[model samples]
Target: MRKRATAKEVADAAGVSKWTVIRAFTPGASITEESKRRVLEAAAVLNYTPNLLARSLATNLTHQVAVFVDDFANPQKLPFLETLTERLQAEGLVAVLININNHFDHVHALLNADQRQVDAVILFGTAFRNETLSDRQLGRGMPPMFVLARDSQIDGVPAVVCDAELALRDIVDHLYERGYRRPGFMTGAPALSTALRRRQHFIDFWKGKGVDEIAILSADRYSAEAGAGSVRHYLNDIDPAARVDVLMCENDILALGAMDEIRGNFGLRIPDDIAVVGFDNYELGGASCYGLTTYEQPRIEMVQAVIGMIKGRLEPETVTLPGKLVVRTST
Candidate 1:
């Protein structure tokens, strides 16, 4: 087997001590400029890869950030992670993704640094609960955290989120202005803070427009099946006198599903019997069958803002952005 070149060998070639060669690999370590340059040049000539474990132990930093997400395949999360990965890479940092299978337990692991490998954390989830990550932890010796989709009022931690309340209010007003009354609502999981806020704002906005009786359905998840089920529940469960003229879903898939249910199950004409709107505006929501009217989240702005927060422009904390509504065939 070929002998790997060690720090000692690099140091000999550079005319520096092995300790000096080691220092080049350590970030924030006390080392002279000249010595650091010579050590790096020698290491390059020797084709040396620094010992990551050793450097991590010495500097007390892994130069790695952990991003927590529920479903990576979800369209909403993909853009954020891709943008963050690119930004972090430009800064010579590695991003480690932690799949949040179990919310409570997985969140605990991401926050605590028993291994000392993670420098910071980013999450797409709503809020970390008291049992998962407490206020004490937020105030203590915890590394920086960037939370997306929640407010920035968690102690001093930074958050990058879209203003759900404002977005929903805007959407509701747009629909109302378009002469859409008897608005029906298909809301998402109440546990999610953003979802709850959007639902409340949507209802309040409808009520403000003189919509006395509203059709509202609750769904278990944000999926096509849930969307279809919510519509069915609305058609079956509601009183015959109360009819829904406009359907507003909290997600694109749900909107698509509701559109399907409205056509197939109820034999109703879309936009003729009921107009529909959705959030996130997934491609499927804009299918030929269901050109869904929905809000396009400022994906670019949100991504850039989060990158800026990670880049240290906005003091690493939660930042909420706004969204715009687009009309479609469904409406």
Candidate 2:
């Protein structure tokens, strides 16, 4: 087996101190261009790289951010994760993804992240509850935490979320303009149905406009199958006259399923018999087959805001950014 070159060897080759080599590798560390060039040339020749573990030990910062995610079934999560990870990498940080499931919850993930000595933690799952943030077992030495893509009401914890109020207002105005008097909302699992305030905001926005008796349907999960099943059940339970003119879904995946169920199973014509709308603006929503009219969350902006909070450029408070409504044939 071949021996790996060390930093000391690189320093000797570069004719500089080991500390100079360290500064050359460290981002934002004070080092002259000539010194950095010498260190890099030596490192390339010797195939030497700084040990991240040793660097973290010396700096007390891993440059790693733990991102907790659940709801892997939802396609929207994929784009958000891609955007977040790319952004984190661009900022000279690494993202440690942690999956939160029934077997392992947010509390468990928190402890695990803390044990890893991550620089920060970002909660990206909708399944997490506010009470979990207040859990006594989390302890005081836990790393700084932020909530992404969802509203967090826990005090002192910053959340980078879409402005639901503005989104609801835009949706309601568009629906009313399109003559959608009776509105219905399709929500995800019971755990998330209450956790996300979009459902309540949808109802409130409609009620404020004097549109009473908004119908609500709950899906078993965030999958398209659950969405299709929820629509199937709702359509079968209610008479045609009592049906809503437009159906709004919590997310794009649910909306896709609902459309499939409405068209494939029931043979209903979209925008004529009923209209469907969704949030998150998943890429599939723009397809010609579905042409789903959904709300486009400012995903990039929201991610930048989270990074800003992490970098101390922005305050760790609830930051809400506005999203635009996408008009398509479905609506």
Give the top-scoring candidate (TM-score). Answer: 2
Question: How much does each candidate deviate from the true structure in C-alpha RMSD?
Answer: 3.6, 1.7
Q: Which pairs clash inside model 1?
A: 158-316, 158-317, 158-318, 159-317, 159-318, 159-319
CA-lDDT, candidates in order = 0.73, 0.90
Q: How far is candidate 1 from the true structure (C-alpha RMSD, Å)?
A: 3.6
lDDT per residue (tens digit) for residues 272-321 in model 1 = 87888888867676667778889877766776776666656766655678
Q: Give the TM-score of candidate 1.
A: 0.82
- Per-candidate count of clashing residue pairs (backbone under 3 Å): 6, 0
Candidate 2 to truth, TM: 0.95
Question: Could you give candidate 2's per-residue lDDT for residues 118-137 as a string of tens digits?
Answer: 98999887767778867999
After superposition, which runs of candidate 2 have C-alpha atoms over 4 Å from their true positions? 32-34, 191-194
